[model samples]
Target chain A: MAKSKTHVSHRQYDDEESGWACMNWFEYMLVVVLASLLLLGALTLTLFWALYYAGGFAWTEEPARQFNLHPVLMVAGFITFSGFSLLLYRICRCCRRIYVKLFHTIFHALAIPCIVVGFIAVLDSHNLADPPIANFYSLHSWMGLVTMGLFALQFVVGFFSFLILLCCEGATAAFRASLVPIHASFGITTFMLAVATCLTGLTEKAFFKLSSKYSEMPEEGIIMNALAMVLVALGILLSYAVRREPFRTQVKTFVTERL
Target chain B: MAKSKTHVSHRQYDDEESGWACMNWFEYMLVVVLASLLLLGALTLTLFWALYYAGGFAWTEEPARQFNLHPVLMVAGFITFSGFSLLLYRICRCCRRIYVKLFHTIFHALAIPCIVVGFIAVLDSHNLADPPIANFYSLHSWMGLVTMGLFALQFVVGFFSFLILLCCEGATAAFRASLVPIHASFGITTFMLAVATCLTGLTEKAFFKLSSKYSEMPEEGIIMNALAMVLVALGILLSYAVRREPFRTQVKTFVTERL
Candidate 1:
């Protein structure tokens, strides 16, 4: 909209290109490296943390083992899936708009069950404790629930606005224009809330399980911290991927002319 | 800027006027209300949490008393001051650019000492304990330090780019234009990091002190949770305030034409 017209300088085009522009060798490699690192780091650390400390996953027979699934699923679902969703438009910029939308929606849809199951696993763990621990007591849980609610709300709004309403004759261009930015902003906000929840949850677990040993920086604690950093990096990269263009309409001309 | 040159639809002009346009009565009132709520919530909750739970501020006589200053200063410095700095442009949009810059810089400068003192208070409490607690061990501590470092880096960069270098003939127009977006992004990132740090620290403290009582949701636990919620709300509101417009250039034109 208004951004499409703005021109700070030739440098504005360069600045936009640096992140949002077509692929160059260095920029392409940087994206690949960042995406790979985020994917690999989230996978390896979640598995390591789960298997080594939380005792891996299991079925109904082992409730404690079910508890292990929470962090793993959290990393995979909340961080990894959410991150990939943020990267979807960037990764598939050449794809049809419908294709990108489908992929984005599917990715987030897959994430939902993982998170739901993860929440259930944690709740189950608490319930199965000798003297059943309380559920939703901590700030982590509060924030987690809020993020999930917002995510679901965002999903519904997006689904209606982009998918369903687009097919209907009544959907106005004005509405879509306004909704897109808010949708994107909420997308990042939800991802960040997820990251914050994970960080706090990790810290809580570290202290609860390690007690005095946490102060010593035990292996699990180190792994958890490393995972946290990876999540932070992913968050930053995701922001880079999804942040709105400062100059949109002119940017299109610049990109067209340059290409 | 190219923004001043391009024309979108009349609707875009309207949209730009809605938020990024001039300060309309409703929008102005909304910002004022949000800022007031954020400041009041942060201050009141921090004080309530500290006084009711941590036993308000004190000096050398009791290290625990000294520890009370940490949360107070964190809310005041990291959240409140940082937030106001983000809002400075909007708050003083009618003022000259130099006046806005001066106010922003001074606010941030004031925040630095608050954060520094807060950090020292926590360190002092750890050292002065009966059996000195370890320093910089927890993820909270690590992330908090990292955020502080980023904030400091951001301050120095901003100081040089905006205040010092602006006066020098060598500070090219292109350089200043590029610096603005990055500076704004980092400001928000640093603030989010601070909020995350505060959440984790609060959770850690609640559990450490309350233990099982926390599960039952003691008055202190409730207060801490309230404080945490306020922080989250403040973060959300800050995001609404400072997020970079995707259509900045077009926005300027739309605003100019509409007004």
Candidate 2:
């Protein structure tokens, strides 16, 4: 039974490879290019909103302005860096699997500092307010905590299971293969959670800062809403990109290699 | 090639059935029970928050109280009913495929009235307010619009393609089969969008209603936050239930029947 299953899979792989040639490269390119733009666009929109409307970044010296860094950096870390990292599998489908894994790790590694600094920026902004506003009280903050925790867990587990286990590739192959779907599913869930957290955060900021002016749809409010829309679009686009089976890596090692 | 592929799938299906018997029913029971509780829990929590804290529901007479119906009914329509409809595939795995489809359709059909009324309640509440609050201006409203639009589209398309096309199943089998994944994917996406929209709406309400008291985490604020958390938990659980391979209907007709 096992031999027959392997033989069938081998045949299916060849068939899928041939089918890939007839597949519309146009659609593939469009998804890749649009995803790339949206990944970068989300960060760009956040930066533009922060600098132009909300006061731009500052450190301990100007805590109110420092609050601006929270959205920008979080978008940079959680949305842009993390999004691009997830997209690497689809975008670099032709690349060697190890190289793709390295790039994935490298991109997520870059996001950690942004997340750390972003976390501190918000904390300082809240703590150093003249009135010293309480932290972690809002729904946004609670969701952010969950998103960050999941991100950290996914990073640690993924790094250990996929990369560290490679030291005993033959012995660990079955164990690692079993982990792939769980990792992939949770990775997408984490991304969705991050997007949800950002949406709530945007809503909180709009109401807090804009107050009555928000209903009138001021320039800054519109910018922030547009930025929110971009993030929503990213959530839809990224989910589709990742879930679409044809876009999936065709090789059998996908079970263990192309996480 | 086609004959070989069908033979392989037949054998695989039998193998999977045996594997299913050996599979831990405990985990399946846990997931089903937890999902059902969370689905009902989400609606119950929303109702508790609405009635106890938000001043309960009304129609056009008391616009402020009428607004409370928005959250409760939305949770019922979007999360509870839609959730159960989605879960029917997993929950009734042993039932006839046509029966499962009918139940799926029936549940979603029930959600439509709730969604329609929930939408109207909010609009009337906004427009009839003493100072006629503006509509569709906030990020929450915008997200809600997109979610509703997608939900409507998914319902119409699913009903037509899956059910209506069955009248000519032999001719439409391939077309209906192609739509299953798309319908399933978008169905989950719409659910996720609804959850995200609810989170944003909850944040908006927390800041608006709780005002200065929100920072202190008052009882009402906590209730709302707790409701938001339930929705978040639902998002994770439902996504896992739908995406998990073992929970999927282990039948050949999944392509054209189980959906």
Candidate 3:
């Protein structure tokens, strides 16, 4: 975590170097949008877990309880943490490059454990079921596993390219620059996949658990649908904000003017 | 459809484009990747439909037969067509700007009806059911409606901005240029959502049909999983190819040099 003298702060490229001093309405609104999404996504996911527990949650060799952990951990690791990491560059636009990079790395580092634990929960649920519910049988399981694999791959590549490779003497500026868009594309894609997994997984669970009771869509079903919408909205907003080049280009304009 | 003399061919921008003569291995591979995805995607979807029929398709006011149309039309309209439209800028890199523009516009124009027909199938299935299956109840349904809305909005805005506004004298070159990235972003995002819809929908159907019969891994279940992987792979490849900047930047270099 030691600061290197040669490391230029990303904020140094800001249109103004006064440290978040100049604020625009568009930037403020984007922040508001991201914050609302994170808040709503987390709140709804917690509510879902609460509802599951209220309905009946347990831990002792109970397949249902083990299964319940799947959604909770996934939302925590995959959705929330991943969402934060996606926004880190924008959120920390005023910070030094290394700090932003570290924060982004830390958030993703936290996400992996949660995702692994969630996958384990999924496996445990199937294995523990009385009749042994089949694992990896449905498209949901296939997509979930793929999403996790892509996520882990992204994290490893990103860690090496962005964090480690940058320090190597042989690392050219062009190579570092080239990795940006690829890293970003992978990040956005993986985040969207996580959202997709949540939607599909929830849909599968809803049909299995509530479709019979709420064939006409009782309150619980409605909540699940709403949760999915919030997740989708988050994904859309995150992608839009991430793709905004004007903000980053604005930083370059300042550096040019200063020179 | 009249050709504009002012619009130069995109090929001229190629890193010293004499013609299609400067082909590279990377570009060729990208084309191969895209073609394989499109081929595999269409083939698998047709195979899935065929499997459903082979398993015994019903059309007699039976919700199943009507529901069958949903996947076919969706794959036709949303997945295959939308994906092609997304890649038009890349695939048509050799064409003049206006021609590429028109093709992109026309392809999206064609996708609308297919999507509408697909939605109708969804409605018919729900309505024609004996007790009447509820509509827009599941997370998949919610996401589908939302994706449709976003796609329609993108189409409207793109049609006006790219085609209509460009005809007006007051429209600046900078304005048209700005719309390009936004249009591209929405196009890619919407296409990814369509793929996600296919994945979630297939998961729902497979679980309902095969999970019970082949709870321990049936042949049909494996086919469904394979279909989902193909869809996910297609989404990733499409996004990667679309985000590629070298292909587009090569065009701009020619413009800059001429100016």
Whose DockQ is greatest here? 2
Write one digit per residue (lDDT tens) for candidate 2, span B229-259: 8888888888887777565535334544553
> Per-residue CA lDDT of candidate 3, range B17-121, in tens?
433334444674666576566645675665575555334334546666767767777777777777777676554556766677778778788888988987887
Return whichever of 2 and 3 wins on TM-score. 2
lDDT: which candidate is best? Answer: 2
Model with the higher DockQ, candidate 2 or 3: 2
Model 2 Cα lDDT, one tens digit per residue, A1-259? 3445687897887777668666746666887899889989999989998888877879999999999999999999999999999988545667888888889899999999999999999999989999999988888998898889989999999999899988988888877876777787788888999999999999998988899999999988898899888888889888877776556534334544554
DockQ of each: 0.48, 0.59, 0.48
lDDT of 1 by residue, A1-259 (tens): 4366556765576676775545344554576578767866887898988887777789556777888888888888888887877676444445656777778889888888998898899888889877778898888899888888988998899877777766753545566665675676677778878888888898888888899998998887888888877777676566554542342232333323211
TM-score for candidate 2? 0.91
The whole-model C-alpha lDDT of candidate 1 against the native structure comes to 0.75
User: How displaced is residue B112 in candidate 1, in Å?
Assistant: 0.6
Model 1 TM-score, 2 decimals: 0.86
Worst 10 residues of 2 chain B by lDDT: B249-258
State each candidate's chain A TM-score. Answer: 0.83, 0.90, 0.81
- Counted clashes in each candidate structure: 16, 0, 0
